[model samples]
Every structure is written in structure tokens, then in C-alpha cells.
Target: MVLLFAALSATTQAQVTATIAQAGFGDLRPSDGFLVQHLQHGPVSIGELADKLGITAQGVSKTVIEMERKGYVTRTASSGDQRRRLVELTSRGWEAIYASRRARAEVNRQLRASLGPGAPAFLDQIHHLAEATGAVTLLTERRLRP
Candidate 1:
């Protein structure tokens, strides 16, 4: 179990490193990716982003400010309520997301090639373990800590 945990942690770190390196988005952090992923469906408020990221609104605001400066996101007043601000991805933000997806897809392709015939079963087992351990629920709820 300890070895498995260590391996998972190491794999996750490697994947993140690879994705970030290949993303070509200067200064974009992993946490930023998580924040922006939530906005893929549509624009959301900072409070909503904080809720989804399981972080404080202040923290989300700090990150959002940086992202906005980087031209990845934009915050605008909501049409319904001028007092409320909605956050949405800019074209550059969407490009970053696509680049990260491509990087991950490449990583998965390599893993699948290495696993050969056993890849599907291995992936299924991993999914089963995640579900059994309730990791899937935590992931879906966006409650996992960075």
C-alpha cells in the first residue's frame, strides 16, 4: 500500500510537470488549470470558483487576478447583477487547456503502449480502486487538496 501510494504520487507529479512544460503557457500553475477547468462550461463567479476549488474566496481572487493579468481569463460584471462578477476563459486560456489535454493524451498513449494488452484491464482496476476508496467522489466534488 505504501509503495502504491508513493507510485501514484510520483506519477501525478511527473504528469503535472510534463503537462506544464508542454503547455507553453508561461507562469501557469497546476492550480490555475483546476480553476479554469471549472469555467469551461461557462462563466462563474469568484465565489463559485472558490467553492469548486475548495479554497477561500480570497485565494481564488488572488489567482484570478494573476490569470487575468496573463490574459488567460477575464472578469466582467454579470448582466443580471452588475454587482456580481463572472469569470470566463479568454482564447488564450482555451488554448492552454487544449495544450494540456494534448500533453496528457500523449502521456496516456505512452503508458498504454507500454502496458500493451494489459492496458485496459490495468486502467479498469485503477478506476475500480479509485471508486472503492471514494476517490472518485472526492475528485468529482473537487475536494481533493493540492
Candidate 2:
């Protein structure tokens, strides 16, 4: 279990670094990528982002402020609720997301190649464990801390 955890951690860190470089988003962190992915679907209110990220509204606001300064995202008053601020990705943010996706795909391809014939079964077992532990839901719904 320790070995598995170490391997996954190392791989994740390397993949994140590679994704950031490939995306030319050195200013963004992995958490930023996760946050922006949510906005890829559509604009979301700050409160909703806080809930989805399992963070405080103030924390989300701080992140939004930084991202806004970087021009990766924009927050505007909601049409229906003037008090609620909706966050959406900018053109640069979309480009970063697309590049990150491509980078991650390449990393997955390399990982599979390294695993060779055992890749499919290994992946299935990993998914099984994740599902059994409810990690799948957590991964999809919230930002995972390393």
C-alpha cells in the first residue's frame, strides 16, 4: 500500500508539472486547473465554487481575485442575482485547459506503455479500489489534496 501510494504521488506531481509547462501556465497551480475545469461547463457562482471545492467562500474569493489579475478568469455579477458573482474562464484559461488535457493524455499514454500488457488489469484494479473507497466520487466532486 505504501509503495502504491508513493508511486501515485510521484506520478501525479510529475504529471502536474508537465501539464503546467506544456500549457504555458507557470503562474497557475494544480488547484487552479481543477477550479477552472469546473468553469469549463459554464459560469458558476462563487458560493457554488466554494461548495464544489470544499473550501470557504473567502478562499474561493481570494483565488478568484488572483486568477482575475492573471486574466485567466473573470467574475461578474450574476444576471439573476446581482449580489452573486459568477466566475467564467477567459480565452487564455480555455487554452490552458485544452493544453493540459493534451499533456495529461500524453502522460497516460506513456504510463500505459510502461505498464505494457498489465496496463488494463492494473487500471481496472485501481478503479475498483477507488470506487470501493469512494475515492471516485471525491475525485470527481472535489479537489484532492496531495
Candidate 1 local Cα displacement, residue 86, angstroms: 0.7
Give stretches of model 1 more than 4 Å off: none
Encode model 2's per-residue lDDT on 1-146: one tens digit a residue: 97988898688767866777766888887768667867988899999988888789999999999999998999999888899999999998888887787777777888799999999999999899989988898788665642
TM-score of 1: 0.86
Per-model TM-score on C-alpha atoms: 0.86, 0.88
The total number of steric clashes, by the backbone 3 Å criterion, in model 2 comes to 0
Worst 10 residues of 1 by lDDT: 17-26
CA lDDT of each prediction against the hidden true structure = 0.84, 0.84
Residue-level lDDT for 137 in candidate 2: 86
**Angstrom error at residue 102, model 2:** 0.9
Q: What is candidate 1's CA lDDT for residue 136?
A: 97
